[model samples]
Target chain A: GAGVSQSPSNKVTEKGKDVELRCDPISGHTALYWYRQSLGQGLEFLIYFQGNSAPDKSGLPSDRFSAERTGGSVSTLTIQRTQQEDSAVYLCASSLRDSSQPQHFGDGTRLSIL
Target chain B: QQQVKQSPQSLIVQKGGIPIINCAYENTAFDYFPWYQQFPGKGPALLIAIRPDVSEKKEGRFTISFNKSAKQFSLHIMDSQPGDSATYFCAAIKGGSYIPTFGRGTSLIVHP
Candidate 1:
C-alpha cells in the first residue's frame, strides 16, 4: 500500500463490550505505532513495534488495552470491556525504521463507547 | 506528566498573515522535534522537523525555529491561507526512542 491503512473507520460499541481496531502499515516498513486521541486533546502514545523484537507496551493506559502485530505487517488493537471514557479516535502509523524516522499515519478509527 | 506544552490553544489570522505556534518541552534528552498539520477528519501529516544540532529549518511556507537551551520550538507559517486552516501539533522524541511526546494541538484559522 502507499500509506498506512486502518480498518473500520468508525466503531460504536456498548459499555463492557470488546472492540478490535486493525492497521496495515506501509509495505516493508519496520516500525509501527498506535495512538489514542481524545476529543480536543493531544495524542497519547499506546504502543510501538520494531521488527521482530518485543513490542513496547509502556503507554497502554490499562490492562484492558492490548495490541498485536501479526507477520510483521498488520496489527490489531483490542480494548476489553469498553467504557465511555474509552471513546476516542485510534490512530496507526508506520515508519521506515524507528522514531528517528518520520511516520506516516492513517485516517484513524473513531471508537465510540456508549 | 506532559513533556511537551503548546501555547494558544487556538489562533485566528487573516490570509497572507503569518501565524506562529509555540511549544516547550521539559526533557533535555529529546533531540528530535517535529510539527504535524491535520485537517478535519484527516490524519496528521508531517510539516517540518528539526534536530537539536540546528536552530532553524524551513520548507516552503513552513519554518521551525528551535531553541535547544530553552527546550522551546516554534512553527511559523508564512503567508497563511484559508486552506491552511487546521490543527497543528508539536512532538519531541529522545535520540534512541521511538515514542514521541506530543503537545496539545493548536487550531489555526486563516480568514479570507
Candidate 2:
C-alpha cells in the first residue's frame, strides 16, 4: 500500500468481549507503532516493532493487550476481555526505520465498548 | 510520567488570526520535536517538525519555534482558517528511542 492501512475502521463490542485490530504498514518501512487516542488522553503509545528486534511492550496497559507483527509487514493488536475504558481510536503508524524519520499514520480503527 | 506538557487544552481563534500552542518537555535527551494535526475521524498527520539544534522551522502557514535552553517549543499557525480547526498534538522523541512522547493535545477551533 502507498500508506499505512488499518482494518475494520470501526468496531463495536460488548464489555468483556475480545477484539482484534489489524494494521498494514507501508511497504519497505521497517518500523511500526500502535497508539490509542481517547477524549481526555492524547495519543498513547502501545507498542513498537523494528525489524527483528524485540518489540517495546513497556507501554502496553496490561496483559490483556498484546500485539504481534507477522513477516515484518502486517500487525495485529488484540484486547482480551475488553472493558468500557478500552473505547478509543486505535491508530497505526509506520516509519522508514526509527523515530528520526516521520511516521505515516492510518485512518485508525475506532473501538467502542458498550 | 508525561514527558511533554501542552497548555491551553482548547482554544478558539477567529479566522485570519494567529493561534499559538505551547509545549514543554523535561527530558534534555529529546532531540526531535514534531507537531501533528488530526481531524475528527482521521488519524494525525505531521504538521511540522524541529530539531533541538535549530531554533525555528517554518513550513507554509505553520511554524515551530524551539528554545533548547528552556526546553520549550510552540506551534504558530499564521492566518488560521476554518479548515485548520483540528486537534493539535506536540511530540518529543529522545535520541535512539523509537517511541515518541506526545502531549495531551489542544483542540483548536478557528471561527469564521
Candidate 3:
C-alpha cells in the first residue's frame, strides 16, 4: 500500500518569504501529525489532527507556523516570514485511530532558508 | 519540559558488536513505547515497540528491554551491521493522547 506522501522533497526559499509544505496521509488513517527536525536535533512536535476534533497546536513554535487539515485527509504546513533558523526537515505521519498504533512517516520535505 | 530523555547522542561499534540505546520517561501515563530508525534523506520507520505490560520484546536482531518500575527502556541490537547505521529515536505515547513525546535521537554507526 502507499505510505504517507509529502510533496516538494526539497524546497529552497529566501528569508522573510513564505513556504508551504504538503502531506498526504495513508488512506483510512484518522490521525495525522506534523513534526520538525532541525540539524542534529530531535523531532519537534508541531501540530496534531484526529478525525474532526480540534487540533493541538501547543507544539507550534510560533504563530507564524500554522497547519490545516482539510476534509480529514491532506495537510498543509505553512511558515510565514521564514527565517534562517526555520530551515529544517518537516515530517508528517499518520496512524490508525488508536493511540497505541504505530505511525507511518513520509520521507519529509527538507526546507532550506537562504 | 521534555518528557522523554535519551542518552548517548552517538555510538560507534564493529559489525559483530552489540549497540544499546536507552531512553527514560517521567510520565507513568505513557503506555506505549516505540523506537524508530531513520536513514539519511529518509523518514523514520518503526523498528520495534513495547507496552508497559511486557518487560521485553524481541524481533529479529532487535530487542527492546523495558523497565516499567524504573521508567526506562533500552534497545539492544544483536550483531549490528554497517547497514544498521542510522539515527534512532525513542517515543512514548499516553493512553488517550494522540501526541507522542519523542526523545533526542541517537546516531549509531556500525563499522563493517
Q: Judged by DockQ, which candidate is best?
A: 1
Candidate 3: tens digits of C-alpha lDDT, residues A27-101: 999999999999877899899999999998999999999999999999999999999999999999999885578
Q: Which runs in model 1 stand beyond 4 Å of their true positions?
A: none
Supply DockQ values for each candidate. 0.89, 0.85, 0.77
Per-residue lDDT for A68 in model 2? 98
Models sorted by DockQ, best on top: 1, 2, 3
First chain TM-score for all predictions: 0.98, 0.98, 0.97
Fnat of each prediction?
A: 0.80, 0.80, 0.76
Preferred candidate (TM-score higher): 1 or 2: 1
State the lDDT of candidate 1 residue by residue for A1-114, as single tens digits. Answer: 788899999999999999999999999999999999998799999999999999999999999999999999999999999999999999999999998888999999999988
DockQ of 3: 0.77
lDDT of 2 at B34: 90
Better of 2 and 3 by TM-score: 2
Task: Report lDDT (Cα) of residue A102, candidate 3.
Answer: 84
For model 1, the local distance difference test gives 0.94
At residue B16, give the lDDT of candidate 3: 91
RMSD for each model, in Å, please?
0.7, 0.9, 1.2
